[model samples]
Target: MPVEQAESLLASQFSIQHTYYRQHYPHGRFDIIMQGTKNIGRLYHDWSGDVVQLIDIALLSAYRGAGIGTRLMRAIVTEAARKHMRMQLYVEFDNPVRALYRTLGFAPAGENGIYELMHRDAMPFDEEAWASVRGLNNPFQ
Candidate 1:
């Protein structure tokens, strides 16, 4: 694929293959959060249509223990609920953030051992879909 096409495909498109996230790990997915123009905090979701992922809820170390993580997660959940979409994510067994996800209604799907897969039930969207999508205007440009 041409460089421009590939870049356009990644940045503005959503038809991603499922294997891309697991195989690509943080890069193929997390890169969005680090680099997306609208700074949606880069949501990493599966292209498989069965699962949606939220990875690298990353904030600076000094920012830990603050309410920032909670706010970020609540925003993500609100978006999912507004879209009537379910979300899934994994947290390492020893990772400190595991406790945070639990408060947001995410529980273990028990697929990856130490990494727990949690989800929020699908919901109806009143305006969630239109909220952040326009930020990527001219997706192919």
Candidate 2:
């Protein structure tokens, strides 16, 4: 598809999905992912149930592999564990970040077409892991 057509198709698809989501979860959050003063990405999530759905998370090319995404995901993992709720998201089947999700303890629940659905059950927070990521001796501080 041409760039213009692809953009138009994506916009249309997003509009349809956003409308459906708003109908089902009127209070869902659509957040802008920021780095300092720069607008880096967007995160759309629904936080209303026992299983929180991470609708989307995307960062620009310049921000990829910089540990910012890892931190964000770890925080999500911590929060979900704290709440005793599962976390779920879908990623393109060929996405390299699938490894990161696996490292974060997400397992493949299923797949459809080009997307893989992944789930992480609630578990005790890994304080040591979080600490290690932050270069701290303890995470409880």
Candidate 3:
């Protein structure tokens, strides 16, 4: 895709996502992912239902694989454990983060078109491991 088209497509996709979130999670909040003062990504989720659905989680290409994503996932998992809810998300099949989700105990739930639904059941939170990530201060304690 050309640079201009790619940017437009991304903007359009996010617009659609916002609309969907408004319809499904009227009170949901959008979170900006930041590294120090630098904005790095966005996270959109809803915990209104029995399951905490992760609608979107995106980090800039430069920040991928630096353990930031893992920390966020751990925080979600920890929260789910506290609330007795399952955590779920749909990930594109081509996305490498699928392995990270799997390693974190999410399993294949189903698939639709190019995306696979994955789910992790609530369990004990791993505070110690989450504390070990360099940039992530422990959120569980």
Measured over all alpha carbons after superposition, the RMSD of each candidate to the real structure, in angstroms, is 9.5, 5.2, 3.0
Q: What is candidate 1's lDDT per residue for 1-141, written digit by digit as tens?
A: 999999888765444644555576544343333223344333454423534456545544554565645555665666666556688887888987778777766777775866767766675433443344332321112
Off by over 4 Å in 2: 1-25, 128-141
lDDT of candidate 1 at residue 59, scale 0 to 100 = 49
Who is ahead in lDDT, 1 or 3?
3
Name the top lDDT candidate.
Answer: 3
> Predictions ranked by TM-score, top down?
3, 2, 1
User: In model 1, which range of ten residues has the least summed lDDT?
Assistant: 132-141
lDDT of 3 at 93: 99
Tell me how candidate 2 scores on lDDT: 0.78
Stretches > 4 Å off in candidate 3:
1-10, 130-141
TM-score of 1: 0.55
- CA lDDT of each candidate? 0.56, 0.78, 0.81
TM-score of 3: 0.80
- What TM-score, computed on C-alpha atoms, does each candidate reach? 0.55, 0.75, 0.80
lDDT of 2 by residue, 1-141 (tens): 899999999999979977886786677777767776677766677778888888878778898888877777787677778779898999999899999999989999999889999999988767554543353111122
